[model samples]
Target: MNDETAYKVLTGTEFAALEAGRFEGAPVDLADGYIHLSTAAQLTGTVDRHFSGQNGLVVVTVDLAALGEAVRWEISRGGQKFPHLYGRLRMAAVTAHAPLARAADGSVELP
Candidate 1:
């Protein structure tokens, strides 16, 4: 698992809603009080458990360095540590983004 960086998977529509250099985050994030992030090793499980059978999903790579104190490592599902951001996600902090596409067996590749 990567310790230096994290990823945020969002729908294409949610990604398009990002504006003014910030992302409002998903509804789950709002309810939880932080933007949930996934590690490279956890990406597949996150999709399988929460986003199964979905399409047009976008995976965003976030620079942990940019989040500073706003980011927290929290224990979540399966007792794994997940990155959580307390504030709006800054678009400038994203390094790259790509569509989440599945291969055979319905598994997706992280973009």
Candidate 2:
């Protein structure tokens, strides 16, 4: 969870799977009933906690405006507010994306 609204991060394979008109969601997302997105500050923790050791990852900056009502800010880990998409993520909702590469400090840079 984070204080600011930042971009989302996903693996390349996950992004490819999102190519379908409706992104059903990742395994965790499906189990949780929504798409999980991480903000800039939370990105590193997210990667280390969930996506570490994974390659070909991408940082996606999605259009929250496009998501409209589908996006909801809710309290998750550590009681911080996080954006959750209750519905399928449409491909058109994404605005930008880039490789998830770590810096010398081991933190990843956003697209």
Candidate 3:
């Protein structure tokens, strides 16, 4: 199945409920018995220069550390391995925001 068909769109409330332990760590009710979240590197680049013309000039810089962490997360899930749910739980608490994305088919894309 395609990625879109492989996952479900988790509502904000549902996600919050999952975070609040309402689902008991199995928030996503998938037909496969388990759900997986993964990330992939879409693009990476350095801010070589900012445009300056009739409009205005802007400063540009790259956040290497943030990019690095994103790369690491992408790499960690590249193999489609089920991440440690406990770790993800802790990460959610630390970040205070869920890193959720919607696929073309409207399903929630994990990671």
Candidate 4:
């Protein structure tokens, strides 16, 4: 993938797991065999569609380069390519994280 970074939206519980050092995967990701992540352009849609009405949400910045071959670009969600990690999401691959924030235009503000 050309993009060097992607974002993961996590619940409070998931964030806690990640903060502890590593995240094996979310339930969906566990079943799917990969961790789901979105590009900056796809962030708002991901939140609106899958995470609506949720509280205590966190946005995590993942370094795709750090993930290396574990990260794959796959076609998903309206035919756009998304980043998926076939391995655990470790803190070493995370660049930053913060509570989810949106601008007046409704786009997510990256931490």
> What TM-score would every model get versus the actual structure?
0.89, 0.85, 0.29, 0.95
List lDDT for all candidates, in order.
Answer: 0.84, 0.77, 0.28, 0.91
Tens-place lDDT digits, model 2, residues 1-111: 433345666667777877756458888998999988777777788788887678887788777777778888888988877788888877787777788878998888767
Question: How should the candidates be ordered by lDDT, best one leading?
Answer: 4, 1, 2, 3
Candidate 4, residues 1-111: lDDT per residue as tens digits?
Answer: 449999999999999999897678889899999999999889999999988989899999999999899988999999999999998899888899999998999888887
Cα lDDT of model 2 overall?
0.77
lDDT, residue 26, candidate 4? 82
The lowest-lDDT stretch of 10 consecutive residues in candidate 1 is 14-23
Which candidate gets the maximum TM-score versus the true structure?
4
Winner on lDDT between 1 and 2 is 1
Better of 1 and 3 by lDDT: 1
Q: Which scores higher on lDDT, 2 or 4? A: 4
Q: Which of candidates 2 and 3 reaches a greater TM-score?
A: 2
Ranking by TM-score: 4, 1, 2, 3
Which pairs of residues collide in candidate 1?
none
Model 2, residue pairs in steric clash:
none
